[model samples]
Target chain A: MSQPEILNQAFELGYTYTRSTGPVVGRFLTGLKNRKLVGIKASDGRVIVPPMEYDPDTAEELSEFVDVGEQGEIVTFAWVKEPREAHPMNEPFAWAMIKLDGADVPMIHCVAAKSESDVTTGARVRAVWADETIGFMTDIRCFELV
Target chain B: MSEEEQEMITKVEAPVYLKYNFTAGSAPTRFLAQIKKGVLAGQRCPKCLAVYIPTRGSCGRCGVPTVEEVELSDKATVQSFTIVSIPIPNNPIEPPFIIANVVPDGANVSFIHLMSECVNEEVHIGQRVQAVWKPEDEWGYSMDNIRYFKPLDEPDVPIELIGKLTVTGEEG
Candidate 1:
């Protein structure tokens, strides 16, 4: 069979996977549950949003946590005409990497705007939390253009 | 970094589970069905003389399609084996079982299966054995058919007499 045929057949059979994120990510999830956007500042002073467990540059374990502002500035974005499975939005939306105020790096999230024209770089947005959350990244549905 | 900043961190619980669909291939489907019938089946490469257990549609070595169906003899000789103490994910069998590569009489290649009905010390290279199949009701088209391979009371054949069958060398 062709590669695509093989892939299609494989998809029909069910598979499940469970991942265990280390301590750093676990702490970050707790902060999100309390409606806080936390960042981990590296030794070099770069503050990473969605605090990573390991410093990307040095590979050292991160322990410091700082609360960041819920609002952020969109650095770059893509008009997602075709939303993929489990995306915050089911309809056409914009996915942007926004640098939360006081955080040095950007965090990827959906921009809940009616149209592409409604979003652009430097636009202010705020975290839109779900009515109910189970501590996963989906807790924050998307960011609404402020 | 300040000592006060490090002291503010605490552990938290983060549970993540992902689910997706996985489909079986045609060759594996047939293999599973045969296991349900308490039968062990292998796909024979007519051109290469290689018999693939839990049969493969294509030969890895010769790059040819294995079309000929062969009912491999239940009896085989252990070539090499490993004792699996750790659990393998999604496997139905329990841990501490012996998995071995057994070369059936007249087949050039070895097939992997559980080695049972014998003590760990009793398992050795070149020992003659036969498959102990599970009940028909317990069968599935998987290697689970022959529950395990047991030691044969009879004598083993001479190693020299067991010739390596090669497709490139001669016609079958």
Candidate 2:
């Protein structure tokens, strides 16, 4: 009789569904489609790009939209030397906290870099848009070093 | 178009995909090895002395580790079942199939498995069944080695005595 092989199985669990992105975030995504950036005013008057629905400090509904610059600074990042199949990029990249000009809070997004050493704190970067823009976060394909 | 409508995205189609790799534990690994040779085996808890098929490494009732290997027969009794009318994605078997919770003889617990080669409507609790194994050349380290359980000609084990039958032909 042959020995039993170690039981290894690969499986996937997922589903597709439609979701409503109400007012605030909807406006920000809409801005990306129009080749622009939008942010909301926080309770402390800080501009938050990819506008949140509520102010973190006051828990009040935020509606004020402020135009933000596409060029930003890398605040911090985690370097991915080897990317997984599910990751956005196949090559080495950095998942960074970027603070766009005119926005006080940093937003998390990936940065395309040739090597780990290419990314650094406080480095200047600019949004790289996709060829065709849709009202989605991927509209800004990635951030590239400026 | 109005300003509100122009800036709004009411809904968006979001598709999600997640992948995982799973490895069977040591107890099931040992059970699969014997299953590859068309033999049924279970592990017995020393504390409670109850045997479990596709052994879970420890006894659920006694909460103690089970180390004794107990050989079981393919003969089983249907403890409960459901007729699936809806199709499952990526499943080779079609809908309207029988999925049963069956207790293999000599084992104290019931495990879920597919039942085929029998009438779907006639399947019921206490129905006698036996494993329908695939060809020897097709055997592997998976439960798919036994394609499915089919009806057996033996008498139905009484509802009260269903999973209590021991390996030595005695009722517990």
Best by lDDT: 2
Q: Write candidate 2's Cα lDDT for B60-88 as tens digits.
A: 99899999999998888999999999877
Candidate 2 displacement at residue A74 in angstroms: 2.6
Give the C-alpha miss distance for residue B10 in model 2, angstroms.
5.5
Per-residue CA lDDT of model 1 for B1-172, tens digit only, reads: 2553353334334334465565657776665655566655678777777777767677888989887766656777787889888887667878788999987654567888898878887777767788887776766545667778998886554554332423221212
TM-score of chain B in each prediction: 0.70, 0.88
In candidate 2, list every pair of residues with a backbone clash: none
TM-score of chain A of each: 0.87, 0.91
The CA lDDT at B89 in model 1 is 62
Q: DockQ winner among the candidates?
A: 2
| Weakest 10 consecutive residues of candidate 1 chain B by summed lDDT | B163-172
Give the per-residue lDDT of model 2 (tens digit) for A60-118. Answer: 99988899999999999999999998787999999999999999999989999999999
Q: Model 1 residue A16 lDDT?
A: 40
Measured over all alpha carbons after superposition, the RMSD of each candidate to the real structure, in angstroms, is 6.5, 4.1
Go through the candidates in order and give each one's DockQ: 0.21, 0.53
Reported per model, the fraction of native interface contacts reproduced equals: 0.13, 0.87
